[model samples]
Target: MSENDTPTTVSESSETKDRPVLKLNCFLPYQLSHLAETVSRSFSKIYAEKYGIGIPEWRVIATLGEYEVVTARDVSSSTSMHKTKVSRAVAALEKRGFVARDKNPDDMREQTLRLTETGIAVYEDIIPKALAYSEGLQAALTPGQQELLNEIFNRLHQAARERDIE
Candidate 1:
């Protein structure tokens, strides 16, 4: 029989017909990634326009703001950013006089990073704006929905951790 005239059989067509299709719009991972990118870009406009800092720089500044002192490795771990990205961000922050690095006396190769006074000032200025932005986003959801989303996120985090351990 010609290919086009061949009778369709379950075995012959099953590979293509039965295979589940992935819809990017409905995919959880894609949805999450798109949401994250959108939110990050929106928030980035705040600091980028006002303070001339990008997401990486903001992550470094925020991490240092909280930890007070840390290594580039620590910032990478905390921000889930690549070490190279963290290094570049640290260098940029230092150049901007928003971050200071001190060599570890015990380990000359290691450096502790901290926010400078100017960095602290920037952090202080940006925090309220961040909070307001976050609050505005949360305001779109009802309190119950917000609580449910928080719980869902916590569970997802735990599941991811477990999967990573495996």
Candidate 2:
């Protein structure tokens, strides 16, 4: 939202004795959440239509592509997805022969996941497309704006990490 835009002032609620004046449009968390969802949905079309996979599955594939071998728990941590979602995506990928899971030697109860040859080929094909898409988005900004955006993202992420509940 731009500074010139007027925000709806929310000052009261039915059950609240003391409610802070709130402006949803200008709220940082709300704006960030909306932006993230919009970007993810828009970007998902590229992989969704081509691979018939949703956000969770694509996240798993990307994580595996980067790390080569990881557990569902590891993917969950890296992708910030719930374990259940990662588990289901891993299962779908395994069924499609894009991923292989084996019992971890270090802990037999744990499963280790890796991409198969087919998975690697698909990932290789997608990498260039992903890079091109990222470049397309970056094209909208000047080099200085791009650097500033990256810096802002890093700072915000660090702040969020520091604010984690645990």
Q: Which candidate comes out best when scored by lDDT?
A: 1
CA shift at 123, candidate 2, in angstroms?
1.0
Please state the error at residue 19 of candidate 1 in Å.
Answer: 3.7
Q: Local error of candidate 1 at 36, Å?
A: 0.8
| Tens digit per residue, CA lDDT, model 2, 76-149 | 99998989999999999999899999898989999999999989987898888888988998999999999999
Question: Among all windows of ten consecutive residues in candidate 1, which has the lowest summed lDDT?
Answer: 1-10
Query: Which stretches of model 2 miss by more than 4 angstroms?
Result: 1-18
Kindly list the per-residue Cα lDDT of model 1 for residues 27-86, writing each as its tens digit: 777777888888999999989988888999999999998999999999999889999999
Q: In model 1, what is the error at residue 37, expressed in angstroms?
A: 0.8
In Å, residue 141's CA in model 1 sits off its true spot by: 1.3
The superposed Cα distance between candidate 2 and the true structure at residue 48, in angstroms, equals: 0.9
